[model samples]
Target: MTRPGVSAFSVLGVCALIGLAGCFGPPAPAPTGTAAPTSTASPTASATSTASPTAPSSPSVAPTATATVPPPSSAPADPTPTGEPTFTGFPEQVARLTVYYVAIGDNGVSGPMIGCGDSLVATSTAPVRFTDQVGPSIGALLANKSRDVGLSGLVNALYQSDLTYLGGELAGSTITIYLSGQFMLGGVCDVPRAKAQLEYTAMAASGATSAEVFVNGRPIDEVLSLK
Candidate 1:
């Protein structure tokens, strides 16, 4: 007996479909030139191509110039007193004598030396004994004055004697200082004393020297002259 919907052709068609299914079941073989994916640089190469370039390095800094220092200068030396004083107007009798003198007071001060209207004067008893010759007398007097004025020591005993004798005998002698002209004390108070220095120069031939010096119309310890 024949089935109601079945046919011989339909049975043959079903067999053909099953055969086609077997043929499609397995995948086709890979291409001959291709290889399996590996954990290599392919991905990294792609990322690098996309990234930006790095910045350039900065230049090295140069050192600054140092300042130059100058050498020190040589300074001049300071001056000092030589202790050698200058004396002039020496008498021929004492050709090489250097004389200086100062007047002193009871207060240990050297002077309150007063001037006459225009001149300075100092008085003293003859300290040196004389042999009548003015040369020796003047020499002794000058030597005494020099010592009393400033010179001292045993070598200058004559000066000490002169000072002592002058102090003892002529202490009361009025000494006057003469100036070239009259001076005003002004109105300022507290003025006490002044000093005068006399210097002499000679050719070592004169027998004696006068102690008098003139300034203006006044006689000073030494004369202030224009000649």
Candidate 2:
């Protein structure tokens, strides 16, 4: 009986320690010496040990996975620039004013025109009025003359066209030239006032026989002779 009492005391002490460590709810009263534990043992021990192991393993595996992540990529390079457009060398006698033909739809007729002047007045016709210049730099002159309207559109157009025209006269062997000038007349329509820089290319070096000239899309014959 004393041995049994001593054995029960030792079991109670061990159970108290387990309860303090949160391993068990409370100590149970000792049963008969030959009796088995009413609670489970194998499953409780396995769950406690495995629970902590999986938590620490998750952190270790996470860092290893993140370390293998790929780096970001680089961007592409810029494109190369193109060379500027320019004339090789313009001849001295190429720019000038002469009586040129004015095509008005169905009928084409020759008219008196100042070499550098943009406006062409009808010599003999109805609806005779000074309107927009109908030659190269026509849009520019219109834009310049009509400061009221604003030539920003024309300036932009010329910048995009890449080619421009000026007025000139054949003086002996060389050509006498005048740069373009624009002024507002009345209060609205832009008008050409002074000589302007005109551009043209030789159809042939003959310096005679006019070649076809185009402005915007309309065609006329006023090409320059470089010779």
Candidate 3:
């Protein structure tokens, strides 16, 4: 509203002065709100951009470098098959003998294991041959492939060639067998089964009244206990 004696031109002149003041003065504060939404968003966006590119870029370069580097490093990691082969030659039976395998499930289990072994059942009807040095009967027991269909149910703990029968000794009525190799087991029960298999086979092979088994020159106790 115009005051008394105030002309419209004067009012217009006042408005012009106000407009000129705004033009000459600093810019509106609205621009500050529009300044790239800087306070939180800009720094976060910039941080993410910087971190994202670097994180991915560094990994990408590292993978390429590592990929090439591993070929040389891993090559030496297993330079040569330095591990000794389990059992170089297969078992060859020179004489006929009864080879025993652990009886598993109910398939072909003949009866409970003889003598001391409480957990295992065993059977032996597979008439296999044996060599003079190391009974090939044990080889038949240690074969990579186990016995036949009827014998398939048998679990020869030493079947994997994991155990190498070093040899055996025949002194009077008792037979002592020596075996050595990395012993891998299916589970705990295989111990008795393996022991039974060894003793029985040794007994059968030597026609001895009793049998004693050893592994790596030690009694079977160590191997069985470790497993």
Candidate 4:
């Protein structure tokens, strides 16, 4: 009996089936003078990402260059000094002797006397000593004038008959003669005659214009008035 009875659940199932049929059925015809509704989809929102800020980079620097220095040089100094050279020797290297003689003659107004007669009697060349004394060769000849063969009437005016020549020198235009002993004369007339003889003889021998006579280191003018 229970099984044959119609259940409420079965009846409700049939109603639901009918409703579903109405919902799933083909679309109704559009109404006259009206358009159909269009399907509309919902709008969606999209996500956005943000970027961070970075610091600026620094600029690069270049390196500097350096220079090198050189070392000093070394050498020896000069040895020679700067000046004029010195020399030592005699002023004249070679020397010779020449003898002058006087001849005895008669003056136009006076008696016999000795003079050069304005000319030389003879010339002799002999080597002289390097010493301060007069050359011995010339001194000997002058002291011994009597030995000369050609000097017959001629007299040695400078010869004192006892005196010997010590030295002689030519200074400027004068010839100086040094004697070992004193000079002797006979009279006043012998003054000018002796002076003339000496001057002429010295001039001829040494090529001088004047003569200075010295006896025993004393000037002849001190003792005699030769003026």
Candidate 5:
């Protein structure tokens, strides 16, 4: 009776044991029990280091920046200054005064000058400034640089020369003057004008009736009387 069921035993035969793999397609590989998918461990850096090494650091500049705008002015600015510049107690500081120059009509030989000049022909001038009354006045006279080309017909004598006024003494309507430095003249034309201009200018400024001028050490009358 056991022999009679042996045909059914063929149906229970294992597919791997038999060589007919085509019968059940290729036999599924034996399950090696897939080592429990070796627990996928993430990299240590992912958990330990939050920021990536390549990430940019905080900036040195402030996070938020703002601009300040100035308020508009109500009054307009003045372009020019109001007052004149002042320099106190300096030689160059200006002091206004009236001064005299030579007369042009004289032609040098014109009969000895009287009053201010042989001919009292007056005009205007952008005259120099001085400190004292007589000394500085004479200094201004020596320093006179401009020539009047107008109808006033006034001229200067001994100007631009090294002739410097040392000092002067005013006593009893008479002035004694001291001078040092180069004594030069414009020429024969300036001869008489020289004597008149210097002498009279000193007289006018000092209220001296007479002026005695000495150059170097000797009196001008003795050394150089442009007479």
Candidate 6:
């Protein structure tokens, strides 16, 4: 009966260790409340582009126009007629006549003198005969005693002495007085004195420069020296 030494207690200990390992095998399942660390790549950030603000433009300008001015006009000249006679301070109907007188000094020395007077002679538009106008003017000078200055009608004395003043003519600057004959005077001194009175009086009246005496239409050579 004791022949075999097989131990019943040892066999029973090994069976007990196998049963304990089976019961604790595999890691315990993770807890549901704590999730596993997921490696989902984080969504890459999208790159957004931004634009800057722009400035406003200015308006264009136009050019201006200029004005022009005109020049002023000049005045006209005065128009006066020529060749008309001008008289100052005298009436239209009046004319100035120049007559002669004798200059007297101590001791009977005598010479010719000039005097101007106003005479109211008849003036007409028609041509007047010189004898009709000038003869009366000399007569008026001789008859007027108030205007007489030692002049005693020398022209009238020639007329009384038979020296007739036939009608005269004025040609250029010389005046010709015609007589009937060659009349002799009292003396040689009388010739020049008488010629001086007549020549000056005639020139002053008729505006002539020289005088010529004629006897019977013939020119006389020796009459008087007009100094």
lDDT of 4 by residue, 1-227 (tens): 56698899999999999999999999998686765333222122211112334444864555434334434346436647769877553344345654544443444223223432222244454566443323443364456535332534544454544566777887899988876655565555445555554545556656677788776787866645732
> Model 6's lDDT to the true fold?
0.47
Sort the candidates on lDDT, descending order: 3, 5, 4, 6, 1, 2
Give the local distance difference test score of model 3: 0.65
**Model 1 Cα shift for residue 19 (angstroms):** 24
lDDT of 2 by residue, 63-83 (tens): 566578876556435645669
Model 4 weakest 10-residue run by lDDT = 41-50
lDDT of 5 by residue, 7-35 (tens): 65576576445756667676778787764
Cα error, residue 199 of model 4, in Å, equals: 3.5
TM-score of each: 0.17, 0.18, 0.47, 0.40, 0.46, 0.35
Per-prediction tally of clashes: 21, 16, 5, 0, 1, 0
Error in Å for residue 178 of model 3: 1.3
The per-residue C-alpha lDDT of model 5 at residue 189 equals 59
Once fitted onto the true fold, the runs of candidate 6 whose alpha carbons sit more than 4 angstroms away are 1-101, 104-132, 135-160, 181-184, 220-227
- Determine which window of 10 residues in candidate 2 has minimal summed lDDT: 187-196
| lDDT per residue (tens digit) for residues 1-227 in model 6 | 66877598878889999999999899888797876444333323221212333444864655544334444446435646669677443222334455554332212333333222111112112232333344433444333334233334223223223455565666888776665644444444445444555565556555679877665676544533321
Off by over 4 Å in 3: 1-95, 105-109, 112-134, 147-152
Error of 4 at 181 (Å): 0.7
Model 1 TM-score is: 0.17
The digit string of per-residue lDDT tens for model 3 on 28-53 reads: 56756556655576687777776864
TM-score: model 4 vs. ground truth? 0.40
Q: Which stretches of candidate 2 lie over 4 Å from their true place?
A: 1-33, 38-120, 123-227
Give the number of colliding residue pairs in candidate 2: 16
